[model samples]
Target: MLPLKGLSVFDFSTLLPGPLASLILAEAGADVVKIERPSSGDEMRTYHPRVGENSANFVMLNRGKRSLCADLKQPEVVERVRALLERADVLIEQFRPGVMDRLGLGFEAIHAINPRLVYCSISGWGQTGPKASVAGHDLNYLAETGILGLSAGADGAPVLPPVLAADIAGGAFPAVMNIMFALRERDRTGKGTRLDISMADNLFTFHYWSIGSGTSGGGWPKPGAELVTGGSPRYHVYKTADSRYLAAAPVEERFWQRFCQIIGLPQELRDPEVDKKAAIAEVQRRIAERTAAYWCDVFAGQDVCCSIVTTLEEAMDDPHVIARGLFDHRVKSGSVALPALPVPVAPVFRSVAEVRAAPGLGDSNQELLGTI
Candidate 1:
């Protein structure tokens, strides 16, 4: 049986962070119901790249979930939602601190209704911080947390991250982990607790090495100057003659020796202790003299710990990825179907792969709230 088959989640959150957390729960067999605003519903529904009747962004993140539209401002609707919360296993919200309290759905109120409800509030800063009321997004959170300052380009400026690191890593991941912890605690105490998940706060975990280095009087990390942030020749990206890049990570002594031999480095430059700058220059020159394909073939079976950078499309079609059945599940809507967004849930915990579709706005209102 699915692990969370009997769990019910009322997710009053839109967009990436909260939706993604509930999506993981839903995929693990929780009956997640998105409590969206009436009329427009989730703003993600109108995002670009349209699918059957919803945006691909919305469909991918919201698949296997139901939607219940209700205006919390309305007294009747608020009462109906309270009834549902009384029996819900979890509740997720993304509004600013006081918004839920003003709407009468805050943790104190809901905990009174259902002491077993795991209440999770996701925000950029947190519930009681000075910036709690300040509006911010993923980029703002990362920038404020110093994560954005660690990776600067040749121009000495922080480059924009390719993905929403704050949302997925900081917010969604922590929410899932804490929710599971809260569930386990609930099992023991027969009571649930409130989770304060601040995206910016959680981001500090990623800077463990940097934090320790700075606090230990080893000096703070400078952009592009850290070992893992493009400072070291052993762990950096090099451009090939064909303009493709090779992500090389031969950090260990053994791997570095193998990498030096594979790249045909001079005997004197092989030892990084001699002159780090000279070794980097020689490695760059040699890597730039050959095409990415040539290097790929040369390093195919070697333990050099390097790979030619591949595009998203190329990665999706990789033989290893296909063999792993990462895209075996399908997200379907009538005649339209697409690969399910790969989640980190274990296959053993998830049900068999099957076609599923994100629900239309308020699609389950009648079924879930008709009695109320």
Candidate 2:
């Protein structure tokens, strides 16, 4: 049996963070009932690239979950939702601080009805901060937390991240982890706790090395000055003759030596005493002399920790990724078949074949409401 076989989750969240957290729980065998709005449902359902009746984003995040449509403003509907909450083991929401309180489903109100509900609230700045009411997105949280400043380009301009790092890492992952911890604690005390997950506050955890150095009297690193950022030649992206890139991350001395030998670097330049700027330029020049494919072949099966920077499609079709069964599961969206987004649940707890397609808005309304 799955770890969360008998657990029930009432997910009153939309978009990415809260939905993704509930997705993990659903994959782990929790019975997740998504409580969406009456007609609009989750906002992500209307995103571009529709798969059948739902958007690709919504389908991927909401897989293996049932949905119940209800207008919380309606008195009867609120009672129906409250009934579900009484039996739910967890409740996840991503609204602003006072929105739930205004809706009459706040933590205090819900806890009174179900003491064992693990109530998780995901927001940008948390529930009790000066900026708590300020509206923000993933980039805003990264900027506010000083993480965006760490990712500046050579021109000293901050680069916008391609992915929603704050949403997934800062919000979803922490919510799931805390929910699991709260569940375990509930098992011991027979009561659940409220989890306030602030995306901005949580993002500082990713800056552990920088924070440690600064606290120890080493001043905070300037943009593009950190070893992993771009200061070191051994850990940067180098462009190839074909205009593609090669990621060289041989940080250890042994791997660095191997990489230098493979690139045919001069003995004097191999020493750390050489000018870092000059050394980095030399490495860049040498890498640009060959095509990405040539370097990929040279680094194949080597411990030099170098690789050709591949496109998303190429990475998905990589031999190792395919062998590991990373994209083995397919979910049917009407006539179209889409690959299932991977969840971190262990294979022993859930298999790819066991994953179900996302439910339509209000798909389980009749059945769920009847039970309530």
Candidate 3:
């Protein structure tokens, strides 16, 4: 049996964070019912590019879950949501601090009704802070937490990250982890708990090494100056003749020696201490002499920790990735099909056939609210 086979989740979150947390739960066999607004539903449903009737973004994040549309402003609709919460083991919501209280669905109010509900609130700042009420998105959170300062381009300006690090890593992952812990605690104490997940606060954990250095009086690194952040040639991206990139990270001496030999660097330049900038420039020049495919073939099956940078499409179709069955499971929305975005749930807890498309707005209203 799946780990969360019998548990029910009432999700009142809109975009990425809370929905992603609930998606992980659903993948592990929770019966997730999304509680969206009556008319427009989740704002993500309208995001482009469209997949059949809904946005591909929505379909990717919200697979294998049912939807219940309700106008929380109305007294009857508030009672309908409360009815679902009464039977739910978990409640996930992402709103500014006081919004839920204003809607009469805050943690204190819900905990009174169902003491066993694991109430999770995901926000940009947190439930309590001077800036908690301030509106922000992933980039804002990253900038506020100083993490964005580390990601700099050649011009020294912070570059936009390819992924929503704060939303997925800070918000979704932590929410699921805390929910699991809360569930375990409830098993023993017979009571639920509240979780305050702050995307901005959680991002500080990603700067572990930098924070440690600063705290120990070793000084925090400037942008693009850390060893792993482009300070060292052994751990950086190099462009090839074809204009594609190669990520080479042979940090250890043995791997570095092997990488130098494969790239045909001279013996003197192999030592990183032998004029580091000159060595990096030489390496970059040599790397640009060959096509990315040539380096890919040379680095295959080697322990040099070198690889050609791949686009999203190329990464998805990679041989090793395909062999691991990462994208083997697919869900559909009407006639359009897309791979079920993979979650971190253990393989033993999920099945390919269990994947389903995101439900239409209010698809489960009749079934979930009929008795109410």
Clashing pairs in 1: none
| Per-model TM-score versus the true fold | 0.98, 0.98, 0.98
lDDT of 3 by residue, 121-158 (tens): 99999999799899999999999888889889999999
TM-score of 3: 0.98
Against the true structure, candidate 3 has what lDDT?
0.91
What C-alpha lDDT does candidate 2 achieve relative to the native structure? Answer: 0.90
Q: Write the per-residue lDDT of candidate 2 for residues 1-372, one digit (tens) a residue.
A: 788899999999999999999999988889999999988999999998999998999999988899999999987888888988998899999999999998889999999999989999999999996999999999999998888898998688999999999999999999999999999999899999999999988999999999998989998877777787898888899999999999999989999999999999988888876787888999999999999999999998889999888899999999999998878876666777788888787777764454468888899999999997
Backbone atom clashes (below 3 Å) for every candidate: 0, 0, 0
Candidate 1's residue-wise lDDT over 1-372, tens digit each?
Answer: 899999999999999999999999999999999998888999999998888778889989988999999999998899899999999999999998999999999999999989999999999999986899999999898899898888789899998999999999999989999999999999999999999999999999999999999999999998877789887889889999999999999999999999998888888987767777677878999999999999999999898799999999999999999999999988875567889888889999875758888888999999998766
Question: For model 3, what is the error of residue 309's alpha carbon versus the real structure, in angstroms, after optimal superposition?
Answer: 0.5
Clashing pairs in 3: none
